[model samples]
Target: MTQTAQLYRMVMEDHVCPYGLKSKDLLERQGFAVDDNHLSSREETDAFKKEHGVDTTPQTFIDGQRIGGHDALKKHFGQDVREEGETTYRPIIAIFSVAALMALALAVGSLGTVLHIRVLEWFIAISMCFLAVQKLQDVESFSTMFLNYDLLARKWVPYGKIYPFGEALAGILMVGGILPFLSVPVALFIGTIGAISVFKAVYIDKRELKCACVGGESNVPLGFVSLTENLMMIVMGLWMGTKAFLL
Candidate 1:
């Protein structure tokens, strides 16, 4: 019977809370007409919080009854609450999805025909570059994680730092159809090393960990995805190497 809800949320210059926006959207979606009250300054926010006896912004009320903050508002309305730091495969999925789209675009643009082999070639090249970019985002974090399982990185240490740049370089060269001699070796060596490392870690040692295939901060498991990535590189390397030899 409550058609209207009141929301008191922070909207200060330096401190607009994200939950406020979510709370507003939620209210609107649930067919509640919201009186969206904004505390537009630090003093106003603090005063409002003190008056309501609440520690957080985005306090919701229906019929003068306090419904609480964002999570509480959801709970009051019988909605499911998403927990913080939820693990998802979204990072790896996003990287591969973008790479696939890029590959398709290139295949359509350059050759005027979507050849299966060419599409595969582009996919591998773009995916490798994308993975390299992820690794490069936090190289220190990546290296520390990489050393846990990667044999080359565990021994040399510097290889962990250099690997991302090398992979990116090889991928770019492959995409450009240039310098197969350099690109092929780079891909083959690293891909082989990666496959072995993944095999030993997952199959032999039975170690469970997050994959550095997406990035150090990723939630992707350290098994199939990592193995697939390495295998793709190895296959692409061999294919490119053979093509170079034929020429």
Candidate 2:
């Protein structure tokens, strides 16, 4: 009988060897025999090294062959490892710069204030449409990560499902401004969601975590301005929600 043996040496410390847990689960699920030796003390690690000629925690031995650390495990699991880039504020700064330019356009336009507001509204609607379309086009990726599909299925669904409808509704509302009664409510709802999403994006960036936002290429830190923007959106959403409910 040919016996396949898998051994794992791991330290029982918090947040260390995160991949070890994953590997253990995967190996068990795949019907591989696994032997786990937990080293809770330095003495244990030393004794393990004397026995196996390896002194590293989170090390794996397959058929008495050392497979190194986390990187090797990831490679064995068929994961594509890539070099992460140095995080910078370039992308976020660019986005804010564009927003500032739009604001400036609104400020400097020779047109009347009402016309400027209309232009701003249209611009916001178009921008939302663009983001919604991008998200929808890459629904699988975004949905799997940022959005909670199970919760959405049960209740509190994300706006992505009905993004096009919302965009169309916003466009129609901006067109005639006839339903001034409904405007605030719609805006408030969308604004609230947008704020939350932006906040989450900021949180991810601050923690140096990867996100699907910005196409996973850039890690943009969340700034105070982004928080303020979200708060403003929340206020707008509340105003709109109230109007929609009342009138």
Candidate 3:
């Protein structure tokens, strides 16, 4: 028998509730026949909320029992429920994943090589660019979060604001293997400081906090991922520097 679910979600002229779509998708994925109920207007949404005595939309009902919103529906299926402000690796994973794919695509298209040292270099460089873009999107927020752990950023507050730009410059140069003189030093300096700061904050001091690596709005926890980012930069800097000197 096909299980049935009713999902009440907001669908307005100017806006549509993303969670409502997520709920519907989830229901269908889980083999449920969903009766998607759209609240078309503010008045209708408000009246529905008032009648149901709920605070939010995208509410689900299974067997006539309330199942809350998207998160709640996930919980109903015994899936991981990430609450607001909870640490998540989704953003970092996504950025790196796309970067890797891009690197592979570029390597195959340009160099006709699938697995090579240059591919790895491109991956790291592209990842850095992507991460830098995230930070640059909201420098103020990123800097604020960066100040919580970065030693240089704390001592020299302006460093927090400049960090993303530096990373971006280095990444771009590294991607093209150009101006190694400028990019190499910048990458080494920032990478070293970031590694040391993260080490001190998470390992030596044991302070658990969000990583500003993806920016201020991220929920990525300060730990291995943060360390890996700094370490990659350091390695890339050294590799590029050595290659440049050898050339």
Candidate 4:
């Protein structure tokens, strides 16, 4: 017996409901014949919503039973669904993963070796820049989240705004192997403060909070991962500073 599903989605001259399309695709993939119903205009969409007593388009029905929206449809099929504000390390993982690959590529291109110390340096520097970029996207939001746990941000306020730019500058300088004098101090100062703040917040204070390491909008928790970021900056600063003194 062939299973049948009905999908009501918005399809206008200037717009198409994305979730509606997703629902249709999912139904077909799951071996169901979808009766695709399109609400072609605002009037029709409103009418459909009123008739169904639903507030949104892209409603699904299986066996003549309402299955809700795309997310709801996924739930019906027992798929993992991510709710808003859920804690996830995806952003940090992606940033570091890409940074590692980039570092390897740079190392191979310049030194013809992937297992060199420079690769690690490049990885850390690239990751720093990427993290800074995330924070810089919305400094106000980042600062707000940062102040929740950062000691310096709580006291100075402006430090939260300045932190991303400082990290970026240090990262750029380190990557270019230029101005060690400036980069070393900036990295060390911010890294030290960050390390101390994260330590106090997560370990000593024992207050669970979202990390501003990725950005204000991130759901990344304040814990080992956040501490690692600060520690990496500190180590990079010290390593480069030592090299500068030696050379």
lDDT of 3 by residue, 1-247 (tens): 9999999999999999999999999999999999989999999999999999999998999999998989889998999987888878889989999999999999999989887888999999999999999999999999999999999988999999999999999999999999999999999999999999999999999998999999999999998988899999999999999999985
Comparing candidate 1 with candidate 4, which one achieves the higher TM-score? 4
The TM-score of predicted model 4 comes to 0.96
Model 2 lDDT, residue 42, Cα? 69
lDDT of each: 0.89, 0.52, 0.94, 0.94
Tens-digit lDDT track of model 4 for 48-149: 889999999799999889999999999999998999989899999999999999999999999999979999999999999999999999999999999999
- RMSD of candidates 1 onward, in order: 2.4, 16.1, 2.2, 1.2
Among the numbered candidates, top TM-score falls to 4
lDDT winner, 1 or 3:
3
lDDT of 2 by residue, 73-181 (tens): 6677687655467556555455446644654565566454544544554444434434344445656555444343122322554544554345445535643444645
In candidate 4, the residue pairs with backbone N, CA or C atoms under 3 Å apart (3 or more residues apart, or in different chains) clash, namely none
Which of the two, 2 or 4, has more TM-score? 4
lDDT for residue 158 in candidate 2, whole number 0-100: 56
Clashes in model 2: which pairs? 184-240, 185-240, 185-241, 188-236, 188-237
**Model 2: residue 237 alpha-carbon error in angstroms:** 3.8
Which regions of candidate 4 are displaced past 4 Å? none
Cα TM-score per model: 0.89, 0.39, 0.89, 0.96
